[model samples]
Target: MAALKTSTTWIKGQEFESEHDGNKINVDGDKKNGHGPKALLLSGLAGCSGIDVVDILHKMKVEFSDFSIDVEADQTEEHPKVFKDIQVTYRLKTATDNLEKVKKAINLSLDKYCGVSAMLKKNSAINYTVEILN
Candidate 1:
């Protein structure tokens, strides 16, 4: 089995510093220092899937540009507020003929390759939309 480790250290107030491998980031609950933990989860999901999509598209020889993802979530009002639903929007500029390939790449990433998405989907409903830009 393979394992990955990370650590978070409290800085002050509601802020913390997190490190993984050689990289580090600041996390704050008040949004004063860095991204909140929940928001980071959304970022992880997007980044994970985005990497998969880019790799798959490249392997398929699908030329694209200006690719970006926007993620939004609806949270419950309970004490342990959690995302009930997540919407991921993928925007890219590609030839009209490659639209199908682009969709397939994104689908593969979200459904098969993105571990973050798999985990998040256990608690939140994940929906996606694709916009092919001119």
Candidate 2:
């Protein structure tokens, strides 16, 4: 097993630091309201898909100046404050005629490449929409 190192900050609303080899990550439970560990999952999903898209598009030689995934969640008001559904919006731009390749890349990410989506789908419903901006 590979050893992963992470340091947690002790507070009522705690923030922690996770380091893996040469990479560093900061984790705060509640970014805006001093909450729990939900942001980690949300950010993970976004990062996972974001990485997949960039790599896949780059390999296909799709030229783009910017790419971003914006995410929103619908939460339950009861105990645990769990997410009921998540919507991810993607913005993409390219000069290539191979738009189908881009869609395939995204499909592969959501269906296979993203570990976070795989984990979260067990507990909640995840939905996504893509808008190609010229």
What's each prediction's TM-score? 0.96, 0.79
Per-residue lDDT of candidate 2, residues 37-129 (tens digit): 676678778999999988988888777767788878899999978889999887877655656777888888888988888988888888888
Off by over 4 Å in 1: none
Look at candidate 1 and tell me the lDDT of residue 56: 98
The numbered model that scores best in lDDT is 1
Quick one: RMSD of model 2? 2.9
**Tens digit per residue, CA lDDT, model 1, 69-100:** 99999999987899999999999999989989
Q: What's model 1's lDDT at 90?
A: 93
Mark the 10 consecutive residues where model 2 has the least summed lDDT.
27-36
